[model samples]
Target: MSAALGLLAVIVLTAATGYFVAQEFAYVAADRAALEQAAARGDASARRAAKVIGRLSFMLSGAQLGITMTTLVVGFIAKPALAGLIQPLLDAAGIPEGATGAIALAAGFVLATLIQMLLGELFPKNLALARAESLARALASSTLVYLTVAGPLIRLFDRAATRLLRTVGVEPVEELHSGATLEELGDIIGKSQSSGHLPADLSGLLDRALSFGDLTADEVMVPRPQVSTLPSTAPAADLVALIRETGHSAYPVYDGEVDDVIGVAGVREVADDALDPATPVGRIARPALLVPGSQPLYGVIERMRESGEEFACVVDEYGGLAGILTFEDVAEELVGEIADETDAREDAPTTGPDGSWLVDAGMRIDEVVRLTGLDLPEGDAYDTLGGLVMAELRRLPCPGDRLTVALDGASGHGEPDGASGHAELEVVSVARRVAEKIRIRTAAAPAPADRPEISDPPCAAPRPEEASWTR
Candidate 1:
């Protein structure tokens, strides 16, 4: 009867050990955000779980206490009883008396350790991790009861631990949790994309947002020369016409020069019934928000929000208007281009005669490589094809400027015979003293001898198309 009682006590204590193990893991691994959301929607279980999680240190202490006590009780009750049960079996096997007792004790200890580790620790720990949220909610009530029963002991332990931590230069009040840093978040997004758990576009947007804080306003702004402006002294009628022609909602009104921009005038505000059409734009224009070119994009956005202005003029170190950034520009950096009715998009790269291509000056180097399948050098020296050309030549390219260099591989189909090639810059149009449109010509690749020859299409004559480009 005494041995039966000891076996029952061992079973109960082992079960308690497993329960505490599950409780500890479930609470720690559960998503706090998910718990909070459930609590907000009036889930009693989630509310209780969150309450326990709030004092995570104390809750962990309670779990440790329970696990330790239960393990100790099981060890004391089961070891002697199992050894006694095994001793008779060893003796029946004809083992000598002295060796039989030692062998029985060793065998029982090994068996007990294996059972305890498997059932009371590893199995419960894995289950909690796999179904952290559900297990956390299911165990919340029992965990609370355990805490109530051991409240005083847990509090005493917590106080001692906190005091010891404080002595080691640690803040006891700060929550102990692992947080994802920007780099780690980026890696997670990358992995999610690769695993098909996230869409590529969504992954890209998340990555952009993660790095948004590191960007500056100037990187996304329209350069000074590209910003359209109206004279502060211009008549309201002219302002209306400019607005219609530009299709821009706002324009900076300058005192005398672009650098002297004094205010911003919205076309809608000017067209209001309270305003006079004959009035000078400067009289009705709103004061312009001036921001440094070096200001972080996030801070600029906050400033825009607080000031209730969607546009700002970025000033350089010398107090000159460096560029202009609108709310849409900053937002685009985070979420990508927000197209509207005014957007004129080209669906494909223009093919030129003699197996060449006509690309815009603003075409990015990466886009060029992607479309043309040409491996061009990428560096900080230039971002666009036009910029690359200028940097190579050390001068602004004219309509006839030409340069030849070896490509990583031969240009496909329309390029000249050799792996090497030349790019002739045919300036189609100019804007803001730069080539806005350029026609690139390369030597045609020779057709295979076995394949029938295909005729090269005639070059499309360049039409005069030059205007301010907005992205």
Candidate 2:
């Protein structure tokens, strides 16, 4: 009867141990962001869990105390009770009385430990970690009750631990953390994308949003050459033509040159008044936002928002008009392309005959590499395909110029599977003294560069001043 009573007590203690173990693991692994999101959506359980997670150090100490105490009590009761049950079996197996008791006791200890370690520790811990958020919500209320009962002892232990740490020159404080680091979050997104839990487009957007802080205005801006501008002293007819040709809502009004500009004129604002052919373009211009090219995109966006201006002229180190960026550009960096009715897709890449691709020189090198499935080369010295070709030719590229180069690498969109190939790049058109349209002819597979050739004698390397802004 006593042994049976002792066994019941041991089972109860083991259950308590399991509770604490589960509570510890669940909260440790729980996604706090998910909890907060749930709370925002009016989940009562999630709110309670968030509270406990907020005071993680205290809650954790309570869990540890409960686990330790329950384990100790279970061990004390289990050995004697289990030994009593084992002794008779040992004797019936013809073991001698003196040796039988000792062996029975040892066996009892091993059995109790195995049962406790498996049922009380490992099982619940695994269960909690696998379903962390759900388990945390379920356990939070009960844990709070436990902490209320054992608050004094938990605090005492925590204080002692803090003092011990201070003695060793370490400051002890509550170690509660709520969110994953950027790198960890990125890794999670990558894994989710690979496992098909997240769509590729959504994953890419999320990754870009997280990385927006690292981008500079220069990286996302439209270079100066791509922007249309009108001389501030020009007639209103010029403004009308500029808007009609570029299909832009706004254009910079420069005094003499693009660098000596005054302000931006919106077509709608300019058109609001009666059209006078002789009206100076500067008469309708609004103040243009000037920002440094090196400014981080986040700060640029904030500055634009605070100033109530969407268009900014990005200036380089020497204060030259480096480029222009709009709110749409920064937004596109976060959420991918924001297409509109006015967007000209005619210049976009297209499929050509015989495994050839029609590409735009304005396309980013990384993007071109992705689309062509050919290992087009790249270096930090250039960013656009046009720039790369120009650097190689060492001169102004003209229509009909062709170059045969070995394909070596591809990146960003994960194309070509790191294969090598040879490609013929034929210039189809030139605009603004740069290659505007390029035809890329790709072979089926990677091959060694055997017969390198070029058509039209290449020019000498351009002067730094000429290539700096042109390419």
Q: Give residue 28's lDDT in candidate 1 (0 to 100).
A: 93
| Candidate 2 lDDT, 394-416, residue by residue in tens | 67786666776676654333444
lDDT of each: 0.75, 0.79
Estimate candidate 1's alpha-carbon lDDT, on a 0 to 1 scale.
0.75
**Model 2 off-target regions past 4 Å?**
1-6, 29-48, 96-102, 130-138, 167-169, 269-273, 306-308, 338-343, 347-361, 364-457, 460-471
TM agreement with the true structure for every prediction: 0.69, 0.76
Worst 10 residues of 1 by lDDT: 445-454
Candidate number of the best TM-score: 2
**Local error of candidate 2 at 35, Å?**
5.6
